[model samples]
Target: MTDLSLYIHIPFCQRKCPYCDFNTYAGCEADYSRFIRALNQDILYEGHTRHHPRVPTLFLGGGTPTILKREQLDIIFEAVDHGFALLPHAEISSEANPGAVDQSRFETLRRLGVNRLSMGVQSFDEDELQFLGRIHSTGDAIRAMTLARKVGFENINLDLMFGMPQQTPAIFQHTLLRAIDLAPEHLSLYNLVVESGTPLATWVAKGQVSEPDPDLAADLYELACELLQQAGYHHYEISNWARGPLQYDGLPHYACHHNLVYWRNQSYLGLGPGAHSSVEPHRWSAVRPVGAYIKSVEEGVSARGYEERISKELAMAETMMLGLRLVEVGVDRQMFQKRFGLDAVDAYADELSSLQDRELVSIDAKRLRLTPRAKLLGNEVFAAFLPE
Candidate 1:
């Protein structure tokens, strides 16, 4: 009867973006049938071992889950349905690339019990989209959103990024306004991080591109917080905002439930290549290589290539770090005491006091949260919570 959240990674994409370093492959989608089989095996193994039959939330994320044909997508869902029983009101969501979206395809996904669609519409500006090396144009993204709405999709999320090379604050604000006009239920406003080993990193290294200014990015983030809140959206997490007053457990919860499982340090299972999973002290990630993951799962070997047992102190630190990301809820004092047998305020009194002195953290009898000024300096505050 454990309330488990399930995640399935679809590692196939039409092409990789210049900035992306996620474990996804381009031009290898022809082998999707084999990949689906491997994924099912991984799910079956997890279902059997965990003995948790009911799943409350399921998220299909990745390279472009919608890239698979309707029938191909069905095969994966069938395996999941057989392996684990979904709760009656489970939140079933799938991430899609705007370029690959189709009306019929979206309709089929809705028919197959997908309640949410998170579209990767990085930018609605042609220049920005091209700069990001995205295949879809602004027209394509608009058309995709229109089609999704027409096909009975009520709960939708748009994934966007800011702080790109040559992007001015004006242009970023324009993109945000355009996205708001479309009126998705959720918005993920992320700052572009230049990951090492990506094509964009090479561009920066070779002087072909200028990196985004951290100070400018901080200003853009603050602008987003201001604009989104004014538009009646709740800034629930650092990068996530949702339309106001969505009821969950009698609370005004507007955040993504699947991600909440991670931020709240709850247990969840991840299936497919490069997916990470955790159940209390034990955490594991699947083999990074698709071929290797398939081979191992097909051969009845565990897909996990790495595993770790988190220490109690580390877990407490992690909980504090993550829970504080929820700007509204923060870390509840009583919950921390119950879980760790110590007052969070007392355990990290020194760190909290230091941050508070700098006006970066605030604490009351009930919760510990970051101050508005500290939101941009979250990384600095989070680093202080790391186990020493």
Candidate 2:
């Protein structure tokens, strides 16, 4: 049976951060309840498929899943358990903002079978937090970490950001040091990208703010890689690091498993407004508007905005691009040949040789993988997979 992953989106937040463009509504409690009901229906509808087995990972992501009340979560969990088979040791993770957390809430989540927590602690500096328009203070982040530990959460991942407006190397180093002091089991160090429609982008366009220089951002990322490595964290993926064998022991093993499914070209069922899913040739996304999604579900209608069946060639190219993200899951020559009936090494000989000559890639007898330096320019490498 093919393993499946589940992604549940919660689109309610107390406030939307300026840098965020996720499908989220600020202070929409009534809409949240309706959305959860709709989500339950969608899950049941998808469960009729026999091709996919019980999901190994269930990810609750959103504006802030922590914003939901325990009672609301209980209803959603019960509905999901009824609609889909969950493995006994399935990894269940929820994304939470520091300001939305509390001891009681954390304990409640633990009892409800959430095995992992991914906290958004973008920065540990108060000034930087404000600059990013985050709702939490630096102290709030610390307290949230403490509460997670006290509430018996053994697997915790901290999401951090670097290269913000007015951010210097010294400031980023301080933030990194603070995060290290917290000693999270996993860390995701992401560079800030100002999306075109976000407030930060407008600020830059208006000359009110200046983004960190690209060269400086790269330097900071390299520094973080070195620092985290020295602290005994393995740079497994470009932006992900973990500590020792403890890394894959439990929930961390399933950390963002939904995303892993995408990387591995596995199938998934996504529910809730603006959620997306893929199953073999077909890909679909729900309507982004919360009201429309809920109304369609209530009327027993599909909420999909668009659906398309991908071609075999498209799927192969996608698999190559996504699988290359993992340091261990290098491109296997035999697997590629079996999948496409073509020898990858020979088909892309020129590009492969050129990249190898540039010190961006390395090839063993059966596999090809990006070198450490190549990870910094991953987009450029991935672009080679795209057709001209």
Query: Which candidate leads in lDDT?
Result: 1
Report the lDDT tens digits of candidate 1 across residue range 167-272. 8889888889999999988999878999999999999999999988988888888888888888888887889998858574222354688888888888898888
> Cα RMSD to native, each candidate?
1.4, 2.4
Predictions in order: lDDT: 0.88, 0.82
Residue 356 accuracy (lDDT) in model 1: 94
Clashes of 1: 0
The residue pairs that clash in candidate 1, if any, are none
Error of 1 at 182 (Å): 0.7
TM-score of 2: 0.94
Q: Which stretches of candidate 1 lie over 4 Å from their true place?
A: 246-253
Worst 10 residues of 1 by lDDT: 246-255
